[model samples]
Target: MTQTAPSYVLGSSEQEIARLDGQAASIEAATRLLLRAAGIGPGMRVLDLGTGLGHVAGLVAELVGPGGQVVGLDTSARLLDVARERARDRPQVTFVEGDVRSWRDAEPFDVVVGRLILFHLHDAGAALRHQRTALRPGGLMLVLDFDLGSSRADPPVPLVTQALGWVDAAFRSAGANPTIGTRLAPLLAGAGLVDVQTFGVQGYLAPDDPRGPALLGGVVRAVAPQIMALGLATAEQIGIETLAERIDAATRATGSVVLPPALAGAWGRRAL
Candidate 1:
């Protein structure tokens, strides 16, 4: 078997881990829309691949009602531990530690879902095959990820562009596809999934969005080491201490609408 290495851009750290919950919250609305598109509802068994901190899994649990069950899987035990802690009150939810390429389930699932997972994968195609096998007959598989290359700023914020460029470069250096979003449908089709469909959602940041300004700064800071190592940017260019301020100034001065990375979703069903 050919193995693909896992490249997690945000490494395990107390501060970085803490940020994930908020990041999840910021995107919760879009995720719910994708879930609806995937036909997630009561009495369905769900497998949440790359379920960081269990936010999406918990949402799926609620949508599936008490009769359904959700299994949240991840590669990091530390993150899974946090997921377990958050999901302790929900008996229908369980957290497991494993790699997506190799993890198996004793019983097949009705729906397999993931967010921001494929781009970081060594071989998204192989993972998609694994997901297909994990699904029961006629089961659904849905993934939400980004085409960072499609990201751009309106009226252009130099700082935002610079920051995002560094982020994209870092992902490439880590061996992940920065533009995996656009490729989701083809990848699903190649994996032999039928009725494949793809949808795209553009992100527009509001000044008050809790995670907007801070997220850019946090991501840059989190990947600071990699930025330096990759020579994508210098410490002064990243400007961790003042990125938020600069973004704020740009938005206020130009009434600029910050266009975050566009998200694309692809879904298909396994053969019965």
Candidate 2:
């Protein structure tokens, strides 16, 4: 058997990470789901993997309160710097810069949580195994990620559908699993995690919903330039400048536009 390399780190620098964090709402629903799945509470030791800019870590910190400890680990030193800066006043939270693959600490955690991180790993199973080892007996592990095939809406547009396809292809080509949500339960089961559960959240991206449009548009805008630069698809195909226009037209002409519904979460516990 061949050992897989660690996942590719997306944000290596503070500037690069800030750009990703600026569009954090893209995964806000998923974040909430992970938080719920973890069942975090006061006095629980929490290990946050791939803690980008510490947004999720901050939330976990609040959940754990003063009595608990929240340690956020990521591969980017620059990102850790930003996390440290944000957590200055929060003595309960600590930031560490290291690869999750080789991470080991003095204390095992009650909950090990990751948001939108496993999909990027070349060997997600291995990473999950590592996370399991970091957990104390009977602790829970929660993960939230995208399930490309779960995309559904009231109405649909051809262009948006096409764009989604292109985006999925790009993700797979980049060594990321775009359909991690669907497989999360099985993956956890294989990792010897018992009592696994998964769920999803559905919504549409339309002009009527300011947050929906803003969140979706931010993601589109962030990656559109790169997609165009690669010539994977023309601006016309992705409707780079006219996504809102197209969505609005589709909703009016039909009932809704095909905006991929976000996957909610999946979690299981280490058997005691």
Candidate 3:
């Protein structure tokens, strides 16, 4: 089978790994809610796709407890190394370097999940169709992604809007879908998963919310190279050093509610 190479717009730098850690932290509560609803529990094995920094994998380990197993799959060995070190205390979690599209094993998992990954794929449904085979009977398949278009200030913050547009365009130029969150349910259904269901969560960030601004700024920094390469913006315009501070300032001055992208989640069970 012909394979498509990884085309993540965010380069796999150590800085990017750290950025992912912040992103995961910002979305931790939403993720936990989704995983619980997906029925991840004791003794269940899970496959965490594109498991950067192993954040989601570690969460699965917690949900499944000591009897459960979590294998974090990624193509970047460097990111996996960081995932390993961070998840060192969780004996149930392990990291491996491989593409979920083709990697398989004799032992199937009770669930296969991914966060912020479907948007990076050229054909998410097609990929999931094959990857789902690694699931045991009645296993769950869950995916969570961002609806970038839904992000906005309650009273309209221009700086936040412009910055978000820049990040969205960068993903578009790289042939990735930054706004695929709403399509998640249909994508899973197309992948042949049965009993599909959908749920979503979005953040309402206060001016003092450190995690929200930090994630936004970190994403901008991580994708700045793409933004520049695609001629979306110049370095001076981005002003990586103070972007987060400026966003905080804008939100505080207006007392506007900052809404980061909504995380859309979908899951379905394989036929028994």
Put down candidate 2 lDDT per residue, 1-272, tens digits, no spaces.
Answer: 23466435343544456556754656665676568655888899998888878888888888889999999998877778888998999999999987776799888899988877888888878888878999999999987777877664455556456556655666676678878878888888888899998887655555354444443444455556557766787777776567756655655566564455466577899999
Query: What is the C-alpha lDDT profile of model 3 across 65-169, one tens digit per residue?
Result: 999899999888888888899888898898888887778878988899999988988888777998889988899999999999988876777878888988998
lDDT of 2 at 9: 31
lDDT of 1 by residue, 88-147 (tens): 999999988888888999999999999988888888999999789999999999989888
Candidate 3 — which residues are off by over 4 angstroms?
A: 1-3
Question: Candidate 2: TM-score?
Answer: 0.84
Preferred candidate (lDDT higher): 1 or 2: 1
Which pairs of residues collide in candidate 1? Answer: none
> Which parts of model 1 have CA positions greater than 4 angstroms off?
207-210
Stretches > 4 Å off in candidate 2: 1-19, 205-207, 220-231, 235-258
